[model samples]
Each structure stands twice: as structure tokens, then as C-alpha cells.
Target chain A: MLTRRLSLFATLALSLLLVSGAQAADIVRLATTTSTYNSGLLDYLLPKFEEDHPYQIQVIPVGTGKALRLGRDGDVDLVLTHAPAAEKAFVDADYGVEPHGVMYNDFVIVGPSGDPAAIDGGEDATNAFATLADEGATFISRGDDSGTDKKEKHLWEEADVTPDFKGFRAAGQGMGEVLKMASELQGYTLTDRGTWLAMKDKLDLEIMVEGDTALFNPYQVILVNPQRYDGLNTQGAQALAEWLISDEGQDLIDAFRLKGKALFHASAGEKIDPTSAVHESD
Target chain B: MHELMNTAREALHLLLSFDPALWEIIGVSFRVSLTAILVALPPALLIALLLARVAFPGRWFAISLVNTFMAVPTVVVGLVLFMLLSRSGPLGELRLLFTQRAMIIGQILLAMPVLTAMLHSTLQSIDQRAWETARQLGAGWWQSLWVLIREARFGVIAAVLAAFGRIIAEVGSAVMIGGNIEHFTRTITTAIALETLKGEFAQGLALGLVLLLLALVLNVLLGVMRGRGHQTVSI
Candidate 1:
């Protein structure tokens, strides 16, 4: 009886696997950034894609570093992420092909509403950063090897003062998470505008300083190098990439708004000034 | 401080409230680990019996190899499994990565050797007279197998329980192979890692408390089993 019951269970499991295999062609695997996942972009994008296509897309969103790692491992069919240098390295390594610009956003400094650092003035990003260092105000860093974390580290490097003030907390988390930590601690933090705008309703923090050309963050979508991983779903990935670069997709990106505010601008084509005003404004 | 206290109180409320996700996680943990043990147990017991009762060449070397696997960490198990299951890996065509089956495979690899080593000791400790008496009483080799199995049932059960405890609580194997995808492979430990990263302390604390309770409850169950075993032995 025990052996019979066990075999029955095994048979059921085998049938399930068979069913999954029959639908393998009806699936596309995507690896993307935690920002894209946590920011609710994939949640919004997937339903539309599923409605349009018979196949379901399974998104595996990790940190930018991990997303690239997944692509390098050929664990996913496509990747959507930021981190220009890392993306370049991936493409150069022949792990990804045909990388395209997806959207544009910027990083900003947010702090307690009380302005404990008195960080607001017609001050440049470096001076504002120096002010925070001088006041010894707590600042939370998203030490999670993410695109945002990379940007924060770069900005601190540019400030040239090695602003390692008291409470230099590296939380090693996502943008939404690090922002919440900042809110709870009422400490200062660097955040992407998209995640901040999405979460601003829940936060009492104010944008202390932004307008920095050096803080512009861009997102890109890349199809995995099919030659590298023979099992990659190249046709489906290309189809998705074409849709993203198409007029309808670009408009959808431009149309994605949060709390009566636009979060990102389409960066598919058209080369206008990229944060040149930020330097002049400062 | 008040916020922290409020959050802790809320966490307790959610835990006692029997949230659906909590139970789903517990069920998944039990089902996966249970399936893993059930799969590993037969082969493990067979090997243990063969190693203990059968005389064969290089049997000691085989036993040593199994013992060596007993010390292999879950992370290494996960890495090796990831390669075996990934798209570019040797078994890439299988596409088992991020699936529950892959998790079970990891768990089986995780639990089997430990189970074998444990049951080997259990069988070696069994009185040789029990099997000999069963055979003398007109029992065949198969019947004597059952007789010996019954005699060492306590230690066997303990072996299974310990293996279950190990896999159910393991994080590295679960995350790497299962991917800890939400509403999918997110076991208790991986979920705790994510929640703690999000600084969602109430949820994190609630999950941690549940994991703690599970450990405590399993320990109590083991103690009771031992107590009951001692009583059965005396009887």
C-alpha cells in the first residue's frame, strides 16, 4: 500500500512536469533589476504583454549585479537594467546583444523635513554633500551593489572630501527599502526619483537637492546573446525588445505616471541635452 | 522606540491571527522537506543495511565517501545544483532551475547522506541476536530485515526527523535553486532575508517568531518521541 501510494504521488508529479513542458514554448523568462520590480514597472508591463501574447513571461528581478549575473549564466532570456559600465562589460563579454535605451530618470537627495543639515541653498551637489558631512548628519547608503548604490558611491567620490560622517549607514538594500530606512531614521539618503515619487506619500522627507547632471540615471533593455546560450528564447526576447523600442511602447513609458506625477521619460530615440542644464544650473 | 514597540505588537497580532501566507509557507516547508525525506529514506536505508549487514569489497571506502558528503555545506550543494540545472549547464535542456523539483533535488542531496550515516550507526547498534533469532524462528532474509527494522525504528525515525529539520531550516539551497520567488519558492528563511532588507520589521519579526516557534515545536516533538521510545524499550 505504501509503495502504491508513493508511486501514485510520483505519477502525479510527473504529469505536472509533463504539463509544464507542453507549455514551455508559451513562456518567456526575464531577468531585471530590483528597481524595476520594486517600482511596480514589471507588474504594470506584464499584464499587458500577457494579454497581447498567449505566452506568459516569468520575471526574475534581482539586483543589477545579479541580473547581469543571471544573463551571463544564461539563466534568463532577456535582461532589463541600469548600470552603464556593467551593461557595457556584459555586451563586451558577448553575453548580451542589441542593448537598447529604455527610459530615463534621475537620482536625488532626500532628508528630514526639519532640514537638520540645512542642506538647501543654491548649492552644488558637492557643497550640499559637504554640508551634510560637516553637520555630521546621518546618511543612509543603499550598499546593495545596485545601480543606485553605484551612483551614490560615485557621488560621494566626486565630493572629494571623503564624507564619512557619523551614522554612515550602508543598509545594503533596494531603493524603496533604503528610502524607508531614511524615513524611519529621519536621516538623509540618496534615492532615485521614481521610487521616491512612488513612495513619497508615505514619507515625511523632503527633496533636499537634486538638479545634478552627475545624478542622471538611465535604464536599458538588452536581449541575451543567443549564441552564448543556445537555449535562449531569442525570438520572444527580440519581439519584446522591438515592442519596447516601438512608438506604442515608448509612449507607454512616457505615459506611466504616479500620483499625478510623471516618473520617467522615454529615451528610446532623440538625443536632446542629457543633464547639461544640471551643471549650468549649479 | 514607540514605533518599534508598535511594530512588534502588530507582528504578534499577525502571527496569532493565522495569516494565509504564513500557513502556505509552513505547508510548503513541510511538504518539500517531507517529500525530500521520503525520497531519500529508502535508498539511504538500503545503503545503510547493505553497508552494515552485507560483506563486500570497498564497502568501507563507499561508507567513507557517504560520510564525506555529510560534511558538504548547503551553499556548495546549491552551486553544484545551479550549474546542473542552469540553461548553459550540462543539464540545461532540463530547465529545472528555480523550480520546486530542483529544490527537492537539493534537499535530497542535502538529507540523504546525513540520513545514511545516521541509520548506519543505528543498524550497527542493533543486537545481532535479534536478526539471528528471527531467522532461527523460520524467518527468511526479508522477514529478518523487517524484524531488524522494527527493532531500530526509534533511531530511524530520529534520522528522518533530523534530516527534515535540516532542509526545512536551510536558506542557501532554497534561495539559489528555488530562487525564493514570491508566492512560489519563498521559504521562511529567504522571506526573512528579504523582509529584513526592506526594513519591514513587523513582517520580519513576525516571520522570525514563527520560525522560532517551529524550531521550538519540533524540539518538543523530538523530546516526546525520545521519551515514548524509552517507554517502548522498557516495555
Candidate 2:
């Protein structure tokens, strides 16, 4: 009788787990950047992650600012994004627990086949922006606070003269949509080369200019500060951060490529020395 | 001041231009929101109609369930659906996770409760004699239900407006389920969120303006409909 009663209690506990499991997800919400998402890197890497990790990874790819904000608000378990300036500020502000290097890619200036701004010469990013602004080329700015947009604005500031061109346009959309619109309108845009390469098959645009010292784009993965927010899922965020920095995760990043060209260079364990190039020195 | 004014003017021109990207983002938002609302409306109205007119074993419990769902947060709904659609979980074979369909499923769930509860209240608050009059006028059971629906038209519209408002503005479900992918699954709210994160507030601001326009249009449409509804009711 004692044994029977114990078995019944065990069965009841198991049933409770089953019922709750049906209604609740054991997934971790990963807020990240559109570049990381639109490139199709997460879809390739996350299955391996979920296979090894206990929780399913539910990715919410937005802008780095929003991804970090989601972390700041403890709305998501982890963040994968670029834009070192914003990430530094986010880390300094104590919004995210710890930001770790995920990968690096360069931003490219893409434009129509006709090269309307004449920004086609292989000049650096700052010069290209100056030329585009000078020509008032129909520039499609993301207008969204995405890492790419920030970098574009930074380039504009670096080039002293802001262009007074008539054809400036704000897409206020993601990298892919902006690129597609640029293609349709035969305009110019700044995009992370990774997304551009992945979406190249769908566009009539070409890389107008690249090889800018100011074009280096670095990505990082960070956990939300669990201590600050009561709703923070500490274990899940920690798991995501730890996983992205692991050898397997870095390998996946290295393996991620589009059209036989590597999209992002892995930088997880390397020290990012920031002293190489400053386009605008005060 | 001159340069600043020039920059401001450029920004304004950027916003006002009939940029295809602007229309594209709004188009994406409308497609996603309309799909979510249309997918949700039938079930929501059915549940509301049942809750208002029918007496079931769990009548109060059903009402309470819908009320509970009205307050249920979007992320929570995304989380719940994520579980059901994940590979290791049951119904995993469908592989519905991270698709626009999955996002719609999430939004449908999010919008349904608010729609149902609002509709139920509307139907319940209607004059009881209206249903009786339809019934006595040789209308069959389905005809009476249709007349009841027509009589509660304004209330239904209000519920629809509320559902659309709630679903379109929601970022959590769109991000979690739609995965906020560009070119395919991205919506205005999700795009705005991503843009804001990247500090391209201009892009976000543009999307924000569109979203605001959408909200204003919804409000105006509701106002016009409500006004017409009231005028017809008096007649």
C-alpha cells in the first residue's frame, strides 16, 4: 500500500509537468540584429544550439539598439548584434550583463547599376558618403536606429562636409527591404556586406564601393542583467552567452557563408583592438 | 542655423517622398495585420456570440477564460506557441516555427481574446427584444443570428478595431514568431523595433509615422462608422 501510494504521487507530479509543458514553452527569447537574421545565419546555427541546449531558441531579430533595449528591459534572454559604439555604451550603462565578441563584417555602399552618385570608385566609406551627399544621390537611409544606420551616420560625420543632394531618401526599413527598394528605384544605400551578399540574388544593385577602414562591423552577444530585473531569466541568458562564445558556436560563424563567400569573420575569442583607424580626429 | 535648416529640410523631403521602401514597409505591416485580424475574427466572433447567447456548462468559466486571455501579454502568447511548434515538442512535425504563418498564428491567438471579450460585451449589452423580434418575424434560427450580428454591427466593428490596434502595435509576437526577417516576414512594428535598436531613429521614425498614420486612419474609420451606426440606430 505504501509503494502504491508513492507511485500514484509520482504519476501526479509527472502529469503536472506534462500539462504545464503543453501550455508553456521551454524556449529562450533571443533578441538580435536584422543583419544576423536576414543573412540566415541563425536558422543555420540555432538548430545545433537547441539540439545541445535544453531550451528551444526563439530568436527575435531586430536592431542592436532594440535588442540591447530588450536586454535592458529583461524582455529577452540574449542579444546578438553589431555596432560597437552602441554596445560599448550599453555595457558601460550596465544595461547588458556582459557583451562578448561574436563576429566581424564590413559595411558596403551598394547602389544601382548606373552608379548615380558616382561613388563607384574604390574609395573609403567616409569619402563615398561625402560624394553621395555632394551629389545628393538618391540615398536610402535606414532611418531606423540599426547598427548599419549608426555606422552610416558616423561616416557622414567623419567626412566633414554633409552632402546637399536632392535625391536623399529614407527607407526606414531593414537591410533587405532597403536594398530591394534601392534596386527598384536605382538608388544608393549602406548595408552590411553579409546581408547584401545573401540578398544579392533578389536585387539588381551592385556593391558600388567598399574597402573602407571605417567599414569594420563587429557583432557581440550579451546576456540581460538578471540582477537588475525581477523578470530576468538568468539561466537562459547565461546559456546563450556561453554558447555563442563556445568553440562550436565560433565554428558555425566561420562556416556561415553566402554565394561561396564568407559573410562574417569570426571574432569571438580575439581581442578587438580599436586603435587602427579613426576617420575623423577631433 | 542655415546648415541645420538644410539638414532638417532634407530630412523632411526624405519623409515626404513617395519612397517605395516606405510603401513597402506599410504594405508589409498591412498584410501581416490584416491577415492576423481576418484569421482571428471568425473564431473570436463565434466565441463571443456563444458566450453572449448560449448557456453552457462552463458559461461563467468560459467568460472568465476569455477575460483572462484579454489581459494575456503578447510575449506570453509567443512563448506558448513556440512550445507547441518547437521540434521536440508535440506538433513539431509541422515545422511551423519561424514562419509568417507561425507569426499569424501567434497574432491570431493574441487578437482573438480581446476581440471575443469585446464582442461578447457588445452582444450582451444589446436589447434582448431585438433577437426576439427577428425570431418572431419568421426568421429561422440562422437568420435570427444574422440579424443579431447586424444589430450589433457597431459593437463588432469596435471589437475589430481593438483587435487590429492591439495586433498591429504588438512587437513581441512578430519578433518571436515572425523572426522579424527582412523581405519576407518583417512588419512595421518589428522593423521599427530593429531600427530603433540600431539607432537609425530616422528609419524608425519613418515607420513610426506610418504606424501613426495607420492608427489615425483606424480611429477615423471607427469614428465615421460609429457615427453612421448611431444615426442608423436612431432611424
Candidate 3:
């Protein structure tokens, strides 16, 4: 009798787990970056998007590379990321389509208040990086193959410097954790403005350099190609992509702020040249 | 069905290559769990002894608290430790965040409640006359404690094994506190999480297979040891 009851309870528990697991897949899966998720932009915008739509969106925050890979694997219905080259590669690979401009933010070189590298307010990000490298000031790199990490590598390449010194620490972590490491170590790091503004209060670092055209960061949303995967919620993903670029979405992006400062400048509904590096001055 | 066969093929290829990355993750998982269980053992055993043998005010409440703590989520522990270790936190001066030490500390907290609760029950169910007889035979307090522990050695071993199991299999706190930094704090479970999220099913399944094999080997080792030298406790 006891064994019979034990088997029945075990069966009930297993079936309950199965039922819940099945219910979880009813929503649209969107893979996005940590910047959008951590900066509270998604929290502000997703509810508004879901209000008029039939689908509830599930957001998976990961690095740009992983987001694209998830899109390629058809594990997620769509992706929103900021790495242009990688995003283009994903599109070229036939994994995603309809890449729409969502918003724009810029990267800033943040460092200690004392400014040991003395590159504060520099117009050229590469020049500032060269100075930091020459001075051997401690620098933290995300090193996680994130979009931010890719941007930092581009700046290093432009600066003609190898950031391989002992002072350079490649922390395979998120932007917020990297900022904390930089703060504690009094090091310099490159971060998107959205994450910086959201987490600035907790950090002692300041923006040492900004306004370089290369520092411009634009976000894009893309729907996964349904032809490559079976049973994908392609219609749901397209609806989300469409809603994000709508006038309501653009206005919501413009209005979302962190501490009275707008985190992302809205650029939706604009005819953005896909190849153009930066649109800030234009 | 085809994916399963492909994953099996990939797992075999990874295993046959004697891959350094796979072995490194397995090593990290074992090292972290071992360090955490070792660090927690003395304190957990002491707490168990105190709760089991001593009759004090609110002892039942303390026992209930331990029972409750055993069910606490790993993510909650990770979040509390993450805050404490963040640069803006009060203890941030130590700069211990995102390090292997932080991962070990998180795992210690994750495993401690399991160890203490299991060992507490183990000590409680032991024959109380064993302690009394040890004392009557001129055994001192420390000697009597040791005698009781020895009498309940099998249960104590089981508790240690259970704690090891809990910490080794945990992913939430390890990812949050450890940051899943590759070549630094990434364990088998965290690597599996990263790979699975990145859509690298083969690598994730390979690490998962390693974790399962490790658990199987450990349980078998425990069974053999139990049958050889120590009398088994059914519980």
C-alpha cells in the first residue's frame, strides 16, 4: 500500500512539472542584451508592447553573440542587440530578417576621478585609449565577447595598441559587474551610456572621454527566420519587431529616463543607412 | 531524435579528444564543492552536536530554523552575497567579488544548511545511551562527543555526501556570485548554463554528462566504502 501511494505521488509531481513546462512555451521568446534589460528599458517598454498584442514576451538577456546564436538556433523567436557587424552576419547567414532600428546610445570611457591617464574630455576615443595604454593605467575589458567588448577591441585596434599588459584585466562579466570591478580597482572601462546612467550612482568612476563618432551605439531588433526552424512563433516575433519601431515605441524610448536623464535616444521610424557607422552628427 | 544522436556523437568526440576545457570545468566543479564542504564541515558538525545533544531554550526553534534554511533558494543566497560583495556594499573593501573565493563562499552557504540539518537529524537518531555510557566510562566531554560522532559515522558521511551533492549541482548562486568567468570561476554546471544559453547544445550536454558521471562515481564509491568498513545506516 505504501509503495503504491509513493508511486502515485511521484507520478503526480512529474505530470505537474510537465504541465508547467508546456505552458511556458506559449509566450514569444525574445533574446536581448544585458544593457536593454539591466537598464530597465525593456521593463518600461515590453508591458506597453504586450498591452495591444496577443503574445506575452519572454526576454532572455545575454551577450550579443549569444543572442544571435540563439536566433540562429531558433531557440528564440527574435533578438534585439547592438553589435552591427554581428547582426549583419546573422542576417547574411539567413537566420534573421527585418532588422529594425530601435534606439541609439553612445559608449563612454569611464575612469577614476583622478584621471591617471589624463585623457579626460578627449574627442578621440582611440587617442584616449593610447594614452591609457602608454601610461600603463589599470584598464578593465569586458572580454565576454559582448557588443561592448567588441567596441573596445575596435578602439584598441584603431589606437594601434595591444591591451595585453598586466594592468589590463579581461573580466568575462556583464557591464555592471565590470563597472564595479573598475571602481574597486580604480581602473578604466568602456560602457554603453544606458548602463552607465542606470548604475552611475553605485560607481565612483566618471566619464573621462566621450563624443567620438565611433562611440555611437545603436540598438536593433530582428525577427528569427521561420523558414529555418519548425513550429517557431514567427508571427508573434514579427508583431513584437513591428511594435518596437512604431510611433508608440519610439515615444516610449524617448520618455524612458534614468535619474532625469534619457538613457536611450529614440531613432525608430528613421531611414537609417545600415552601413553608416554613426548617425549622431547627421 | 536526430538531435539526441548528434549530441551523443558530439559527447563521444569531446570525451575522446581529452579536451582540456572539459576537464578544466570538471576540475573546477570538484575543487569548489570540495573546498566548500571542507570549510563547512567543522562548523556544521559543531552546530549539529549542540542542537542534538543539548537541551536548551528555543532549541526546537533553532532546529526549525535550520529546517527552513535547508529549503531556502540558492539564488537568494547569491543575491545577498552579491550585494555584500559589490563595490558599493559595506564589505566591498575586501574586493572579493567575481573571484574563485567568492564562488567557494557562495557554495559554502548553499551547502551549510543541508549539512547541518542532515547531521543534526543523524546525531538525534543515534542511541542516547551511547553518549551516557561513554561518559560513564570516564570519557571527557570532548571524548564523549567524539564517541557519539563515531557511533553515527555512517550518517555523518551521508550528510557530507549530501552536502557535496547539493553544492556541486547548484547553478544559480555559482552564476550570480562567480559571474561564470571562464578559466576563473566557471564550474561544470555554470558552463552548461552558458553553453545552453549560447545554443551550444553539444558542449552543454558533454558537461552535463560529466556531472552525471561524477555523481554516479561518487555514489558508487560511497556504497563500496559503506559495505567495506562502515556499517550502513538505513536512513
Q: Interface RMSD of the predictions, in order shown? A: 14.5, 10.0, 3.2
Q: Model 3, A14-115: lDDT tens per residue?
A: 999997876665589999999889989999998888788777899999988788888887899999998887787788889999988888888999999999
- Stretches of candidate 3 above 4 Å error? A1-31, A37-61, A75-78, A98-103, A116-121, A130-140, A159-173, A180-187, A220-223, A230-282, B1-8, B125-148, B221-235
Tens-place lDDT per residue, model 3, B138-220, is 99999999988888787788788878988999988897878676666778888787656445678788888887887897787
The CA root-mean-square deviation of candidate 1, after full C-alpha superposition on the true structure, stands at 20.6
Better of 2 and 3 by TM-score: 3
Ordered from best to worst TM-score, the candidate numbers read: 3, 2, 1
Q: What lDDT does candidate 3 reach at residue A15? A: 100
B94 in model 3: Cα distance from truth in Å?
2.7
Candidate 2 residue A242 Cα shift, in angstroms, is: 2.7
Q: Model 2 segments beyond 4 Å from truth?
A: A1-10, A13-15, A18-26, A273-282, B1-235
- lDDT rank, highest first? 3, 1, 2
Best of the candidates, lDDT: 3
lDDT per residue (tens digit) for residues A186-217 in model 1: 78988878788888888869998887767677
Model 1 clashes, total count: 0
Q: Score the docking of each candidate (DockQ).
A: 0.02, 0.16, 0.20
Number of the predicted model whose TM-score against the real structure is largest = 3
Over A166-245, each residue of candidate 2 has an lDDT whose tens digit, in order, gives: 76655456787677656654678889887888888878788878877688887778777777777555676677778878
How would you encode candidate 1's per-residue C-alpha lDDT over B1-235 as one tens digit per residue? 6766898998888788888867676667777788999999999999999998888999999999999999999999998997777655798678676657888999999999989998898888787889989999999988899889888888788788778888888988887777554445667776677545433567678878877887887787778767766665666
RMSD of 2: 14.1
**Candidate 2 docking classification:** incorrect
